[model samples]
Target: MKKIFFTLVAMSAILVACEGKPSAATKTTEAEDSTVLVLFDGETFNGWRGYNKDHVPGKWTIEDGAIKINGGGAGEAQSAEGGDIIFDRKFKNFELELEWKVAKGSNSGIFYLAQEIEGKPIYISAPEYQILDNENHPDAKLGVNGNRQSASLYDMVAAVPQNSKPFGEWNTTKILVYKGTVVHYQNGEPVVEYHLWTPQWKELLDKSKFSAEKWPDAYELLINCGGENHEGYIGLQDHGDDVWFRNIKVKILD
Candidate 1:
């Protein structure tokens, strides 16, 4: 009986050696870190779709591992779907990370707290993280404390000026929202930061175009936590010109 037991133990040891434990590399790739948010993978469209609607137009295609707006793409408007792509899930306070490259003369922006008003672009309802070919686009040189360039709040607020990379190259942008503070960072540096509805911010809104157009919404910051909702969707802008995006991701904070 002792001899049989020894033989069985030896066999078990051999089996363990043959299989071993998962390698470090395998473990790293299999388990996604909760803090990391990867928006697009080259092969599929997951965690995304069109805004205020169910399907995305065909223009937003995946080519060469990037989400791009090909010429003559699809949209509800028939003008190559110049709408936004959004997270099916809403978030309150979180940080977003993404990469983009814009063709000369193209334009786009990321929008948040996205509310699709009965019939309007999401920009009318939510705040924007501006994207533009600053060197080529006409709107590139137009703001005082808001609007006019990349990372600005799209005509409502100006992002703090930092030299943007040339067109067709990858640019990294970070949008961090926690409580009443909203910040825009470019290439690992913060260019803009603003509290929702402080007197100064409201005054800026009061004097801006948003006052006349997005009037009530302009005052929304005055409400608690932008209407007591700390969570919303992350949207990509299809600025009707042409743009490209990849490595889109987000990390939610408690």
Candidate 2:
């Protein structure tokens, strides 16, 4: 009888202890929930707006659970109503994740650390993650050794392994920026990694089309990159080509 009573008491004590503390998995999930911010809620443009404008462009819409650009197929010579769009908030160091797919022969880009200069385009003040139909888009063949291909640092550094899905298939992308280091992930694989504000970065800028002689304004901005604040808005390009993005989220990193 005494043994039975002791066993019951011990079991009750164990249960109390377990109930008092969350499991490791539960703790991790809670931490993730707290740090993550849903850039798009998959329903409306709650935290998005046109770059340099107050509202989202009419060309951008939610379709089939994704933020899609209804392009005229003109390729950057898009209508006045269509342009790049950006998240309203600025992030300094973060891990951004999204799923994207492009239409046949389409061209688009994901911009980070982008500043809104009154007359300058988004790409002028930000680095771009190239999005394209590698099999059909002319850009896939341009740039040095596929630097202009999907997942590449647009016209600067090529995404190694070149593992972009074919047009119309969803591809997962992750952009991690912390301190001065930037890493691009494609389909769960880290494809490109580089550091900003370094001598190597300066050399890269000097050789790219953003060189001081070619585009002085862009060169000046690209040199400093994120400006004095080291933070900027996330933007999506409307390159007059149909593109779809969904599951956009970010986790601010310390």
Candidate 3:
């Protein structure tokens, strides 16, 4: 009886010692730490779909653990059926990170704060983070300064001293959208930062291509319907060039 009593006491002591310990998942989601979410499983299109489509586009496929699309050929137009793939849910404020690589002469983009609207392309409503083969793509030479270069906030801000790696090499990108402040990071460095819906932002938009009379609807989408709808899809562009992406994740902020 004494041996059994000692065993019970030992078990009770062990249980008491573990009463305040945290599990692995609890360690990952501490209140002081941001809540992380994996956007891609690296195995299938579990939570992704072609922008505005009911299915993953045929041209996009899961291979070697990355989302990939094969283009027409080197320097040829993208003939693939892939248009754009977007995370199905909308996010208001988040910090997102992903890895990407583009083939030579290729172009692609990452878009956020996108509100899907009928009769419009994603670019018509969302802002893009440009992805390009700077050495070869014609667009690399056309924007005011280098605002359209890879890792730039597409057409609005230039990422100084461009840090993109060479073609076929992997690059990491981080995007943070908190309330109205937005920041873009490339290759582990912050490249561009700005606030939305401010006077300076309005001025930037007024002077950019986005302000053309041809896109009054786009202007409205960016400025008018001004609530959580600003919280919209996260998208990957199909610039008709070959591109691959993986390791996509996001952390929500309070």
Candidate 4:
């Protein structure tokens, strides 16, 4: 009886010890099961397509692990085979990260909370994170106080410090959207931040080119921003310029 009691106590203690801590495999699984979603896999266009279209435009292609947009030198007119491309999923609150590089005089943009309006351009329903060769692009000198420059809110607000690395070097970009608050990060620094569906936002829109009197359709959309559901797609603009993007990923916050 004494031997059996000691054996049972030893077994109980072992079981309790095992239950107190997780195994190595459990720890590894928890570490590996991340919430981040890769928007591009470097080889395939699995979750992307042209905005308002069923297929990716031919001007956009994967080159050397980056999404490269072949330029047509037509500015915003875009190429005959080019259009904006977006991920097929809609996210309400997320943190999107990517790296981009542009050729001399190139221009592009990253759009968030975008809606697909038939025959309407992506900028009509989305806010853009301006990407440009600030040193060579004419738009860098345009807008009110350099708002059209790289890392700006594409004319609504200017990115202070204007830390774009010229044209050829890669720059890391991050866009965080959570509960009506949006922030744009460039090269690991916070550049622009704004809130949606607020009086200040309305005031900003009213003062900008998308005002109710100037562009009523865009004003209506920008006023609401994310629509009834407050969810929208992520998009990359093909502004008829040579641009490259890679390491695109997003982490859902909602």
Question: Model 4: which residue pairs collide?
Answer: none
**Taking the tens digit of each residue's C-alpha lDDT, what string does model 2 give over 183-235?**
88899877887779999889989989999999999999999999998899999
Task: lDDT winner between 1 and 4, please give it.
Answer: 4
Q: Write the per-residue lDDT of candidate 1 for residues 1-254, one digit (tens) a residue.
A: 34334544653354335454334454334236564667687667787788776777676888788888664333433453546778787777678888888888777888876655555666655678888888888788766653768988666566665557889988999887766567788887677776664676666576665664556654454333235465567788776667888877776544
What tens digits encode model 4's per-residue C-alpha lDDT throughout 160-198?
Answer: 768999788999999888777777889987778777898
TM-score of 2: 0.88
Index of the highest-lDDT prediction = 2
Candidate 3 lDDT, 31-112, residue by residue in tens? 3554678898899899998777888888788878898876654333233355778899888878899999999888899989
Error of 3 at 193 (Å): 0.7
Better of 1 and 2 by lDDT: 2
For model 2, the stretches where C-alpha displacement exceeds 4 angstroms are 1-27, 30-32, 75-78
For model 4, state the Cα shift of residue 21 in Å.
20
RMSD for each model, in Å, please? 14.6, 11.5, 12.8, 12.7
lDDT for position 72 in model 2: 85
Query: TM-score of predicted model 4?
Result: 0.86
Record all residue pairs in model 2 with backbone atoms less than 3 Å apart, i.e. clashing: none
The stretch of ten residues in a row with the least summed lDDT in candidate 4 is 22-31
lDDT, residue 55, candidate 3: 86
By summed lDDT, the worst window of 10 consecutive residues in model 1 runs over 21-30
Rank order (by TM-score, best first): 2, 4, 3, 1
Q: Which of the two, 2 or 3, has more lDDT?
A: 2
